[model samples]
Target: MSDQGSSTSTSQTDGDFEGELDEEVESEEGVKEKGRDSPTPSLSNFSASLRAVIRIKQKYQAMKKRRQEMVLGLGAGALVGAPGRTSPKIFTFDGLTPSAFPTLSSIQQKKKKRRRKRVLFPTGGGRKAMPRQERSRATYCLYLLLAILFLQVYNAIENLDDHVLRYDLEGLDKMLRREVFGQQGAVDGLLSHLKDYLSTYVHNKPLVVSLHGPSGVGKSHLGRLLAGHFRSVVGETLVLQYYVLHHCPQEANALECARNLSSHISEMVERAEEEEKIPLFIFDEAEHMHKEILDELWQLVASKQSNEYLNTIYLFLSNLGHGHITKHMLHNSSSISMAMTASGRHSNLLKELTPILRNTLEKLHPLWTEADILPLSLLEKRHVMECFLDEMTREGFYPDHTNIERLAGEIDYYPGAEGREYSQTGCKQVVAKVNLL
Candidate 1:
């Protein structure tokens, strides 16, 4: 009985112990469950993922900003090297980083703004900034001025094809066409001055009219016409003399021979006075006249063979462009007075003239007042055709009126401005074509 009790008690104790162990296991599982349900149980893993995502976003933003900065920097650099910018290339230190471009908060810490350094153009000392339109206009103006200057230089070096003394009065008279053919309006201003001089200078007054212009601009042609016109009017009985003064020796003793020459001139003047025809003196290349010779010529004009012939008309022909003459000789106040041709206010040409010459010109103002010819107006198409017809008739190749009318119509319609609108060449070409037909 005692052994049975002992075994039973032992069995009970073992059963209780196993049950406790199972309960402990269940408690351990419950604790594990509670741990899993805890709010912060996976905090480390969650934190790691969040951190990684944040880092990725930051890297992407940084890369994007860097790319934008690089693009901006490259564009700025390319613009700096462009041609004709005139502005100097600027190397900016700020473009290197995003932080360099300040926010409003950091602006107070920023350094004072510095002015951009000016870049000078190599052609001249200073750099001048011009707008696009102004720059283009300036470029065009420069090219045009250069072209004109080149043409002027070329003409100066070439020999003049026509002589001023070749055109006789008869030819000039026919050319007048102002009253006859109605083309005088083209050159009336030029002629009016001559007419005034003729009327005011007392016919025998030794007149000095300077004709100055650029080479190949018809100064010589005009001079020839003037000389011939005077010759025709005064008759061949009067020795209407034209002289091209040549350079003589510079020595003081050679002046005596010059005086002898002057005496011979005086004799000629006296003889001219004896005749009723006015004695006209035309000096070719008056710009090149020796100073002594000029002085002598002036003396001759002043000298008189009694009251019969008071002064001889003097015409000085020059082919130097108007500016050159004004620059060297026409600065004087007398230049304006002595200018018997132009009646208007002093032009750029008058301002450049010598002051002494200006005063001399003012004395001749009366002659300018007597001018008969005015500014040239455009010639009618019909008148131009008539003149062309007259020349063609003289050639003995009479063009049909229908053909002439057609050519005139074509010329009138051609696009051009004054001086080049109706070309003389076009008319001649028409005549030639008609003759061929």
Candidate 2:
């Protein structure tokens, strides 16, 4: 009985399964029929289908986003752990490390070696400083050269004044003092002017000396002495002695005389300049010269003349101021003798007489105004006696003092101040008197 009950139960289960299958088939057919009968879709059915498709697209997008997030998380984890791992070595194109290249390493070593060499030898060979003593010696040599240059300049200045030595001024001074007696004042004035003019080669104008005195007070004698002396010094060709009476007499035409005098002066100056020498011109008896002749002489000695005329000496011996000069000496004999004795006061006597002589000469001709006037005093009785003795000796006679005094007494005298007797004709007649003896 238990076996029977088991089969019935099994059959009933099979019957139930068959009934479920048939119902499912019939329901599918009924749905198809409904689809055929309706023909068009409804609004509700279409909306539901659209809702289902949207939900499916949303789900797909959510899946893709999750996949990307997972991939990024994996990459971040690898980077965070990369620092703990060993770094790979980089290599150049030649497959060698940069520091391992031979050329680069040699270049760096050479640069370091050059730096060391520069530090050790800065000045190319390390030259030492000069010793202190040697430096001082060099400085001393420089100073010695400077001192020698100074001495050379000093010697040059000293030589500049030596030009005056060639004229032999010392001998001239002695000759004037020794030979020209009783005219010490006149001699001094003459020498001073000569020395000043002859000391230099350059001059602005010619030296014009005018000697004024009475006939016998050595006016003509002095002029002759000067002419002779200059002839000896400068040569006879450079010295000219012009006598107004002899060369240009009163009977001669005034214009002819003037022309002759001018030509003579111009010729002399030209010759002297060529020889580089100073020429001397002596004019005796100048008071008798015509106004035309005087004017010609004035033009020659004027400062406006050519430079050749400047280096000349002119002597005008005249008796125009004789009376004024003699009168002055007689009135001031004592004071004049004193002044002649004192060297310092010698110029004072000339200062007093120069104006009187100048005024007398200027009245005759304006040419004398440019002259350096030197007036001679009247000769004393003693001076006249000296003249007598000199002339006696020259004539080859004994210069006896008694004879000299006797001859001097024959000359006229102007009884001067302080019991002084001055000769009127001075030494003018001494020669004639000596001849008589």
Candidate 3:
């Protein structure tokens, strides 16, 4: 029985062992089958991986296009981000992507290009545009205007110091003759001295003239003539006429005249030196002017700036010393009565200032008359006739020249004067005389 039991156990043990081994082999097969069923890496898997990678790249490309569109939209221009479109979509991105947009210059260039294309392909042909001749004329006009503007500017700059330092004395004489009638010798002498004085014009060395003559003589007339002629030399002509009886009478007004005269002169001469012109100050009826006024003038003449003020002429017209001059002439009547040759004798008479002149004027301005004091003499018959004709012409009356001699004989002369000689009024009444004719 022991043997039997042991053999049975052995058989069981073997059977169990066989079963276990079979199960083990089956588990191994199952494991191998599972492994085979699962996915295996191959060429097809590689292709599928490449396809995934291509899909990601396409997504990235789309994002870049969106970003570019957003950047173009953000450009600071009204005509920006593709024209004729509004409400453009803004692109979104991951962290802090740098933005870019088109510049104004680029946008302008694009607009210009579009305009050129439109112009080249207009609705009509080139004939529809403005005419070529008119367009060319407009362009030429613009060029000419610019050229004229440039020339005017250039001339203004160049003429800054334009002044007449030297002038034609003979021309001045001719011009004076045309305007001022009779007193040919006086006119000629006045201009000759004036020309010579102006030739040596320096700052303090002014051309001072004391026109001492009879009341009706051409003292004031000659002054006007000088101013007119001076206008030709300087581009501008202005006279500061101080009619002593009119502006500031002698007595109490002389001091007032002195003060006002200084101011007046200063104003006229303020820019005179700068503009390169000599200021003309005419003291008419100068004998009537106070000694104080003369002193004031002397101060101006002696001023340091006076030496710099060139070509300035101070004209003093007066009848103060005429009586003395006439008396002196009467003493030497035979030689001096001849009006034509009276010019040379005038200097000699003035040199020996007659009793009345020496007393009244010598104390006033002793040196004022040291230079040539022009003494306008009485006019003769021939001079009066010429004066009458000139007066007629000035009055716009073209009376016959043949009637001039006959017309002059009718004008009245002084009691001592006869034979068509001038009156005591000289050429003063000549204008009225011609008017009556």
Best by lDDT: 2
lDDT, candidate 2, 14-86, per-residue tens = 4654565466456555655665688786776556556655754565466456544544454345446354324
What lDDT, from 0 to 1, does candidate 3 have? 0.64
Q: What ranges in model 1 sit over 4 Å off?
A: 1-190, 197-205, 237-257, 302-309, 324-437
Candidate 1 lDDT score at position 158: 49
lDDT of 3 at 389: 75
| lDDT-superior candidate, 1 or 2 | 2
The weakest ten consecutive residues by lDDT in model 1 span 368-377
Candidate 1 lDDT tens digits, 1-437 = 33343345545655655665566556555655665787656766556556655765665566556655654554455456453334433345753787766788665444333223444445776866564553567889999999999999777544222222232433555565332333242244444444444443244444555554433233454556665666675655443344444434444544664576577666656776666434666666655545456566655555554544464556566543444442332233233343333223224334434343444433533322221211111223665577457656767856578766766666533233322233322233444544564
Alpha carbon lDDT of each predicted model? 0.48, 0.75, 0.64
Leading candidate by TM-score: 2
Q: What is the TM-score of candidate 3?
A: 0.53
TM-score of 1: 0.34
Candidate 1 global CA lDDT score:
0.48
TM-score of each: 0.34, 0.64, 0.53
Residue 392, model 3: Cα distance from true site in angstroms: 1.3
